[model samples]
Target chain A: MAQFRLQGSKVLAVDLAGDTVKARNGSMVAYTGQMGFKKLSGGGDGLRGMVTRRLTGERMEVMEVKGQGTCYFADKATEINLVRLNGETLFVESDNLLCTEASLRTGTSFTGLNGMASGNGLFTTKVEGQGWAAVTSHGPAVILRVSQGLPLRVDPGAYIAHTGNLHRALKSGAGWSTLIGEGGGEAMQVEFTGEGLVYVQPSERMTLGGEV
Target chain B: MSYPPQNPYGQQPYGQQPPPGYSQQQYEQSHQATQAGMPLPPQAPPYQAAPAGQFGAPLFQPPGGEGPQLWDAGTLPANDNVNPYCFSVDLNGAYYLQKGKMIAYYGEMRFSGIGRGALDQLLERNFNSPLHASDWVVAEGRGKLLLADRAYDLNSYDLEDGNLTVRSGNLLAFEPTLQLKQSIIPGFLTLIGTGKFVAASNGPVHFVEPPVRVDPQALVGWADCPAPCHHYDHGYLHGVLGGLRHLTGIGGASGEEHQFEFIGAGQVLMQSSEALMADRSVGVIGAEPGIPGAGVPHQQQQHGGGLQGLGNLGDLGRRFGL
Candidate 1:
């Protein structure tokens, strides 16, 4: 467990493994996982030197902060980016998780939630808060906010953050023939609906895994 | 096939029948003429006669006919010691700034496309510049200056070693190395002059001069003062993928920026300061005092127009010599 301190509505803590301290507002909930960081001067002295190193591409472990107030976690993963969104919501992710404060929500039921298909099982760890929430990512994420009548769909793994109110559904790109190959057709999908935000990693899962 | 000439009861008409065996040659000629269609009216040849020893249209054909032939494939003598200022691409295509006038790659001047026309103005006026202020335009960049739309009111003063100097009326300077330019916005001008600066709304700014001493308070100032402006973000977005022309960048993915269309309107997006480098989500804060459209914040609107007149009107009224 990482140690965290509270300041006003914000919580600051050092990631024991990653040696980095993270601060977040109490109104926000953050999850932690093993992510990478690189060495640099920690932005603030209150932050430990080890934490700064982690921020600069040093890998650290991951954890989830349920209640708000800032919480810090570290991992041995590199590449960290923070994205901000509307309504003071922030989304955090590790390994190419591109989420922002605008995408925080508790539920899903939107047009773009599940590739235009209804009843798709698309679930995002939603956070409903009114403060700054910090998220991390290995690569950049593309945020797209679709409006009413127009929906959005994305690969579940590619989603780093999203809003809660957007409806959730599952879609299958595989047709009947393709389904036969996979124990009777279970295609990968996570659909979203209504008017809300969706964040996608710039690269698709196929390309990213190919690189690895 | 041979046919007896229609003689109207064995009488030959003028220009109708030729001597025997001449018909085959005539048939061949007619066949070729019909296949080729009517001949074009002969005019002076398009290209001047190729000088001796110079390759011409025939050279365009592949030597073995194995690969598709392309014109202008042969390499020419390389040019040495070219200046960066001389060779750059504007809207139309690659061009060279020879003497003072800009010369296009194809030597034609009339622009045929809107994108090229915009590119023309960008490269000629905004490349490798920190600030360019004329009567109609203003530009800011790191080593390259970029004049945004509606910028003709700019001054032409070259900075040494790509150093940027802001004129009294001008309020923009960009650092080339960092590829960032500083321009006027609420609460940014005075603070940017000092290395200690702040970006209020999560805007990306290249430090013209490094922060001599990194102070947390100063860093806060740096974080709070300059929120990236709207037009600049568009420009940066257009050029972001230039770094990776091949892969792992914008070029490899789409080789184009995705344009979102507005409902029944031209493509216009609401500009905000927080989404400077916005990737996934955009955060918008209506700092305009009082709820918009309910009651106009008269004082806020007046001050928000700019920091120049609102701050100095009172002082200027008192110090008049006349």
Candidate 2:
């Protein structure tokens, strides 16, 4: 059971009510339950200023809320939808994946066969077969076509998303290093070359998701 | 019991017997005539008994008198065989000391295990290093190959031929040229052939074989430090974790940016929504320049330099006194 709703500014809402998931956004959506606001204090002007700036939705430090129930307002979201794939496997980010059809076995980065403590320790849920998979993000996700002949190398830090039969390796190219602030110095890049779909974040997220 | 002389080629034989201390003439004659196919005096000379006044009993004189017994095995003292092909479940330490390729060391060692120093010590001590004489010592010290060390799969083990095969493990220190068979099992490490071997928790087979070429570079990738980053200190653990992240993608970022402040030499302030902000905040005060606090004039306080004139002293006095 799943549904979509539009409400508040440009914020997209994915509501999981009982057995169904409802996606809503626009001005019509409102916080019906209770409202709680806590003032942030202390710290110097820079940090305090940043926190205060976040309230206006102009800062990069954005707080996102996702769970079951209702929400009042959301902003800076473009599009939202449900995507499904074959095989007994589903790869997704910790934040993007909202719910799964089958029971998921949650584990740390080390639990994987060769999974390292990489990607800023991003938690991934390996879903088996098909059922229901719900996901959300700050903005619309970009699905890029990656194949064996024309593969893509991305900085893991800039990797917003990806899915498929993908093998990851370390990558280094000329233009890619320029953005790293020093010829990419110990810049570790993620090489995704295979028949799979990759999602990339527009901006670099400083979650320690780059080369070691 | 005496051993017959070993023929280099199992099927053939050398010709006539060269007298003890065979003259060059005798050697040439023996070498030329041995292939005639007649078994004459076993072709090579018999074991030579010591003459009257000689020091030790002469076991057997070599065909060429100058060297040790060349053709007679009976001349030499008997010793146990260390053939890896043979092993008894009951033999335990003795067999492994002679056959195993990797051995663990529980503590420290006085000398490098392979060199003559350790071997000499081993012989003197009656064959006991860490894992025993039979086990080929793999690591030298306490943390060499810990139990927590990763595991792989074993696929084949032909004991008769002394050949073994195994699936790759997370072992950064494996020999690449070593023979192995590859197979995939989604969730478990499975054993394939026979012979003593270790199995991965998820099921991968691992077994022993004769020493083969091992590519140290390929096996270990690169050390934790020595990475491309200049700011990377070998002691910094973050880069190691990050490498693991880059390598395995096990724990990825939480899709949030974070700011870390170097409070002191060893202190840090990680500022993120995920951080424990209940009691501790994310910023730093009095932080040195080029550090966390944007442009704060860093006060260089010496370690042993106590706060004596700190209260009364204004500028130079406080700066110099401590």
Candidate 3:
């Protein structure tokens, strides 16, 4: 198994010994030992994932790094977060996924209207199985727990990812006044209910619904 | 040799234990202790433990009992910062914020633009800058509202019968107790009376007393002081060579030739960087004669055409080397 650890808040250091890890294309900033880099034609999910990503417009350019030594990966100096999955699934935007251990299975899932409002399309990338996956955020992402009666409402642009069993629905704060340009600036939100942890960056991306 | 027993979650590899949640009292003590010693990193968990509430969720600890502190409604601070870049407001009544500054919120909240009829009363009392009306919105109802702006450093200021003038783009949100007005200086807004207001800076804000001449890009705002005036280094443009350098970059004009000069009793706020936030339009002023920046004819109009139809004569003098 490749060992994934943070070199700092913004860099991910993965120590591998003849093991492979899937990472964002061109995210490898430096490496200390023999490493083989291969571009996975279709997100490393084979033909099915490639086809799903193409059709859903959730395209992810991924590269496979196999080697023996420490490899560092970073993206635009954004903050990196490491998540450990114990036979569970982690759903995140493809743009926010920095790298994932090859042991984790990567696939695409339909996110419905929540994705459209966030300007991220209708499909989200999911990493499952047991492995360490790294996610990127505009800032240090805040992890909020949503369980039972306590629900979490996230601005579409600030939401990065979530894990565990949860239901997401698009909730609109717009009303009749919104029609006349008096609408709440936060016109669209993703309401998460059930048990899970949501990751929200302290910064908002420019979304289609943000100005409303 | 074994990499110090890597934890399953990989959080232990760093070896620095994530700080435990501190109750209000403990937080205060730790804060004072740290203040007495080495300062805590700016991103250190600045939130306090949740006050007991009806819907208190179990504090979330990541798989290895580590990672960023998990925040929910109960734990969110009231009118305080969640991190240096994020602020949490315990909203019960109403709060005015620049549109789209909110990242997330827990509870019942409605965001309405300032133009709505329902917010007319609120605007009449707290909002007076018609020019900035379009750039702001009101968050009302109950719950915890989070406000952030491009992940910049966010700090909240409390004004007690005082006034503050900030760059339009830096002012994020404010309590209703403060009445907002347009500053005479273009691209700045003034807040009067008492209440808390949140502002964002490119970096941590530093306070300096005037008389001070500050780089325009580094200035965040000023409190209880008169607006600043522009100061130009006369020596930089004194002679022919200086004028040529200023005009055509012949001798490399220093970028610090111009600054905002402040000479008053109050404090001036400046960010550590020279990167200025995108300026928000403060709206057009009445084009009346004798009004500065009113789009009326002025002596120093540099643009080609003037209100008097003078054509491109503004630059004709430079062509003749006059």
- C-alpha DockQ of every model: 0.01, 0.01, 0.53
For model 3, the superposed segments whose C-alpha errors exceed 4 Å read: B1-66, B299-321
Candidate 2 chain B: minimum summed lDDT over ten consecutive residues — where? B80-89
Q: Candidates' lDDT values, in order?
A: 0.26, 0.29, 0.78
How closely does chain A match the true chain A in each prediction, as TM-score? 0.44, 0.53, 0.98
Model 1 chain A worst lDDT window (10 residues): A203-212
lDDT of 1 by residue, B1-322 (tens): 1112231212322123432222445433422321121111111112222222121111111123321111110110011001111111121222211111111111112211112334445544333222211111111111111111111111111122222222212222222112223223321122121111001112222231222222211121222212221211123323335322322334343322222121221111122222221121112224466533223444533323332331222322122211
Query: lDDT tens string, model 3, A148-179?
Result: 66677999999999887789999998788778
Distance (Å) between predicted and true CA of A196, model 2?
1.6
Give the better candidate number (1 or 2) by TM-score.
2
Candidate 1: where is the Cα deviation over 4 Å? A1-79, A83-124, A180-187, A204-212, B1-322
lDDT-superior candidate, 1 or 2: 2
Error of 2 at A106 (Å): 5.8
Question: How far is A177's C-alpha from truth in model 2 (Å)?
Answer: 11
Instruction: Tell me the native contact fraction for each prediction.
Output: 0.00, 0.00, 0.62
Model 3 clash tally?
1
Per residue, candidate 2 scores C-alpha lDDT tens digits across B28-115 of 4433422121111112323333332121211212234421121111111111101111110111121111111121111121112222
Q: Give the per-residue lDDT of model 2 (tens digit) for A1-212.
A: 32233342143333434433212222224543333222223111146444543432222222223334554334334223234433334455544444333223222121232223334342343444434344444333323334434445443444544456677665432243235322222134555655555554322344342322
Compute the lDDT for candidate 3: 0.78
* Residue A16, candidate 1: C-alpha displacement in angstroms: 16
